[model samples]
Target chain A: MTIKAINVRNQLRGRIVEILTGPVLSEVDIETAGGIVTSVITTRSVTELNLQVGTEVLALIKATEVSIAKI
Target chain B: MTIKAINVRNQLRGRIVEILTGPVLSEVDIETAGGIVTSVITTRSVTELNLQVGTEVLALIKATEVSIAKI
Candidate 1:
């Protein structure tokens, strides 16, 4: 399925640098221009997306899920 | 309560530029060095945090909740 658009406001494009797979979830790290953006997705998604080291991907973050902290 | 630390991997420090409040949620626009990071958090959090224009904050995103998209 082709995703033409997504509601997620933050989209950081980069290449996969590492993958730490677990029983149910996997941590996929992407190296973007800003920095390394890490994403922990379901193991199923890792397999379904055929994600691997060097694969280009976008780290998507929903605005609703974002938390604000005073600093 | 003071939070010493959080598990969220991504944290962007910025100053609140705008805020659109609603009944339940609010869209907070923050200006950071990278760019403008927008967040839609609960209005209750807005009140509790005393968020307003020019408020300095960190936009936090958990790795577990970040989605990966191939590009």
Candidate 2:
């Protein structure tokens, strides 16, 4: 139930803002350092149970989900 | 080619660390505020062409990619 956040160097990053677990898929709170809060759900069971607000979370998200953009 | 970063409210966030476009799919550099750098690719044509270092990027990642975990 302990899913380690894969650090994708030269990619993207975030912090574990919140942690909500369930019997089925678990939702992870990701607060993008830029001030955005993203709730990520996973089928894997998380039991570490040490997530808190402002905790560092990594987004090893795949390329299919992310794309280049200009602000 | 003006693709906007979809902000996943209550989800993850990041900055457009870099933007390298090609004739086809484009590669986006996302520096997670926390420190992880992730590259996201998209088939959509991004024409805004206004990305740079330390730019705010939103992850809008799907639940299937995110999961909860302890420290």
Candidate 3:
């Protein structure tokens, strides 16, 4: 598979429903227009970006590196 | 699948081969005693942990969440 500049492989269109930034990993909760499709956790998110609730963002993914779950 | 205290699931025993820390994320380079089986990218690893070269580590993985390929 082709590796992007960063590990972020594909741009997944989603809206930020919740963002829980703690002492460690930043959990950016996203909800796609389709349904409760996926949840992503990345170490890269920081408070300085000002990524607030109800923000529109892309859940960049590596198709080869993605895992799907149903809840 | 059981979720560990963290996203880290099953421990795929490996050794800390290398580590690259940048402003954004920490890239942990691990090599299994077996061979180049897998590589993991977690936002949780830090320099303070002193996860150094030849250090023993567990490349925890989620059974249901694992994807495999060759290099």
Candidate 4:
């Protein structure tokens, strides 16, 4: 998916530090240059991404209300 | 901070699930309606937010290249 924003605030990079799997949700921890970021992705996404500890990923965050635009 | 975008794809609301403190950086876990969202903020932000395990916060993410736009 492509995400374009007129105002982008935060985009941080980190690695998967840990992954905690639960019956309903899975917690993915990412260790970045600055710190560690955690994401609760579906067990499906986890399987799709094949995310494991030490995988490099990016965490994109915007400190505003987000709307979708079709390009 | 105000985050605005022409295209916003994902915005999830979650509660603070956990916080891991280190010497320089801190890990923040937010439990949302769908899942958990993790953010790596500075120790300063952690202190400023006064984030605990149960703090409710919004985890805003956009799957795109983000730029800053000033209004």
Candidate 5:
């Protein structure tokens, strides 16, 4: 299904630079303009999305799950 | 308690620009180098962290929770 819109605020657009596959979780690294955005998602999603190196994708991050650190 | 290190990979440093509070969760808009990073964390964390406007903070995001959207 095609998503019209999403509530996630931080959406970094980039290309998949690397994919580190694990038992359950997989790390998909995207090279964005800001920097390399690393995302660890389910291995199942990795396959379902047909993700690969050079595939353009957006790193979607929800507001609620974001933690803050004092610097 | 002071945290020595964390496993989260994405840590965007920025300052709090705006805060929209709610009953349970609060929206924290941080002005980072790339852009405005919005976070919706628990109201308790907001209070416990002593977050306020102009507070310098690092927005931490876990890799596993990041979603991928192909474009």
Candidate 6:
């Protein structure tokens, strides 16, 4: 699938090591060479993507959404 | 700030623990209660956001960009 979002610059490649599915939300853990990139997505997307353990995926992140805090 | 993106469902709150700046892209490490949510963003955004270590920010992730792969 081709994503047209130009701000989607980060494409971290990793494997789906674990998935915690919920009714409204789902937590996916992607193990990369650097570290584990944990993403909380929707259960609907999980079902649509057919994501499971051992699945390889690219965690695309946009800089705009990555808000910074000073805590 | 209000983000117009309705699909931005996941909002992981974390502190900016580390940042690796480059010419174009910058890697930011956010430490959250759940885990570390790493984001690769443009250096410009990082500068605009004035991100620094110990800064607290929300990592907003859109489900669509969180692609899945079966490996």
Best by lDDT: 5
Candidate 5 lDDT, tens digit per residue, A1-71? 88899989988788999999999999999887667789988999999999999999998998877889887
**Candidate 4 residues B1-71, lDDT tens each?**
45454354556677888999754467898887777777876555688878899887767566653477899
TM per model? 0.85, 0.51, 0.40, 0.41, 0.86, 0.50
Deviation of model 4 at A23, angstroms: 2.1
- Per-model root-mean-square deviation over C-alphas: 1.9, 5.5, 9.7, 12.9, 1.9, 7.9
Arrange candidates, best DockQ first.
5, 1, 2, 6, 4, 3
Give model 1's DockQ, 2 decimals. 0.69
Give the CA lDDT, 0 to 100, for residue B67 in model 6.
48
Worst ten in a row by lDDT for model 3 chain B: B36-45
**Residues B1-71 of candidate 1: C-alpha lDDT, one tens digit per residue:** 88898888988788999999999999999887656778998999999999999999998988887899988
Off by over 4 Å in 6: A1-7, A67-71, B1-71
For model 1, what is the alpha-carbon lDDT of residue B61? 84
Q: Is the docking of candidate 3 incorrect, acceptable, medium or high quality?
A: incorrect
In candidate 3, how many Å is residue A41 off?
A: 7.2
- After best superposition, candidate 1 residue B36: deviation in angstroms? 2.8
Indicate the TM-score of model 3.
0.40
Error of 3 at B14 (Å): 2.0
lDDT of model 4 at position B43:
57
Best by DockQ: 5
In angstroms, give how far residue A29 of model 5 lies from its true place: 1.1
TM-score, candidate 1, is: 0.85
Q: Specify the CAPRI tier of model 4.
A: incorrect
Q: Which ten residues in a row have the lowest lDDT in candidate 2 chain A?
A: A3-12
Kindly report the TM-score of the first chain in candidate 4: 0.70
Fnat of all models, as shown? 0.79, 0.47, 0.00, 0.25, 0.77, 0.37
Compose the digit string of candidate 3's lDDT tens values, residues A1-71.
76456756676677777665645556576788655433434445545556777777776666645444443
Worst 10 residues of 3 chain A by lDDT: A35-44
